[model samples]
Target chain A: QQQVKQSPQSLIVQKGGISIINCAYENTAFDYFPWYQQFPGKGPALLIAIRPDVSEKKEGRFTISFNKSAKQFSLHIMDSQPGDSATYFCAASSRNTDKLIFGTGTRLQVFP
Target chain B: DAGVTQSPTHLIKTRGQHVTLRCSPISGHKSVSWYQQVLGQGPQFIFQYYEKEERGRGNFPDRFSARQFPNYSSELNVNALLLGDSALYLCASSPSFGEELFFGEGSRLTVL
Candidate 1:
């Protein structure tokens, strides 16, 4: 029940293409959802996040689309660049809990 | 302002040995959390500390324990470490509970 399932274990996109990663969770108690980007030999870094109250949120070229009824969320990268090649993770957590359940992760490779 | 910092960026230990990993959260941040990431997998929550008190713990075994100091620095201790315990240990910090999290580079542990 604590798991956050993510899809497309790996992805390949060309520069200027669109990249998308999807995630779903079973725990309805999760009120907070965040996406993290991780690079080789480094820790995961916060990329973008969204809550159930809003259907979507955008930051620069990154956007997060959230669906409350489906218990699913996705991260989209516009005009994907080689610099965007990294592992992306979707995470969920509840205010009542101190832990954030993370997805398996998606390795995104943006080719030039 | 420095980001979260972890000690012993890399280490090796034999099975049944004990090991201690340390983390110093960002200055003025009071909330600290620990996570374990096996290669190619998303991070799994280990423990969370706020105001020097343990606020939450994950499904990890009792062999994994942690404590926070007055300075808000934290330590993760593992006893009878097994080969399965090897992974990247990450420390994240936030201003308070239910907020944005910043993660450090992480400490890589390899058990023999």
Candidate 2:
């Protein structure tokens, strides 16, 4: 029940295109969902996050659309750039837990 | 301000051996969490420490252990290392429970 499943093991898009990665969680206790970006050999960096109380949250060109009833959420990178190319992971946690449950990563490649 | 920092960027161990990885959290942050990321996969939680006290632990075996210092730094030790233990060990810090996590570059452990 702690699993957060992510899909599109890999994605390819052109510069200026939109890149999206999806994730679903099985635990209903999860209230916070966050997305992370990881470059090769580096630890994951917090990109954007949202709470279940809200339907969406945006930070710069990155946006997260969350569906509380569906137990799913997604990250959308607008105007995707090569610099944004990296492995993206979606994670979830609740105020009751100190640990964040992460999803299988999605490798995104934005081509010029 | 310095972010979370990890030591011995890489190490190699053999079966039946033991290994230790270290981490120093961001100044003023009292919560630290450790995770293991195998190649091409998301990080799996290992342990979490808050205020020098263990607050959470993942589904790892008894061979895995960790401790936190008064300074909020931490160490993860794994005994009887197996080849499956070869992976990147990541350390993340947060100001409090259920907060955003900032990570270090991570230590790469190779068990042969």
Candidate 3:
């Protein structure tokens, strides 16, 4: 079973615009929500993360807005740049488990 | 200082063969996890080990097995390679279980 689901499979945005990706999970036991970014031929890098106690977390231009009640979270990138163009994945994990359940991923393309 | 490192960046094996992938976690990290990323899909958790002991495992067949050393490094072994096993195998390390993970570039495995 796929615990986490993410959408739109692909996205296109202009430089300096805002880019957004969303994900939802079915397991309410999940407490840690994190987003990762991956470039071609590279490993996924930790972007930002949020906990259920907090509704939002921000790091630089990347922000994670989480809604615990809805079991949903979204990633927002302000001033999206070409450098930010890559595959974004949202993941969820429970405190009792060491594995992470990842979303299908969103491919973002930033155009100049 | 060094991030997670994976060895044998790429490997090719024929059906009925076996393979092993290695990973070295970041300094001071005690937890290591393995994930499999198929083409066009997000990564799926395979196994997690903490302090040289298995902590969690995903819904994978018995063909997949992993072990961690006292030094916190890990090795993933897959037996009887199948074409369906062709994917990028990623290794991640965290300070402890359920903590943020730092991933390595990954080892690409191709089974013929």
Best by DockQ: 3
Q: Rank candidates by DockQ, best first.
A: 3, 2, 1
The local lDDT score (0 to 100) that residue A110 gets in candidate 3 is 99
- Candidate 3, residues B3-80, lDDT tens digits: the string is 999999999999999999999999999999999999989999999999899998999999999999999999999999
Scored against the true structure, residue B76 in model 2 reaches a CA lDDT of 97
Per-residue lDDT, model 2, residue A50, is: 95
Give the TM-scores of the predictions, in the order they appear. Answer: 0.98, 0.98, 0.98
Per-residue CA lDDT of candidate 2, range B32-53, in tens? Answer: 9999999989999999999888
Clashes of 1: 0
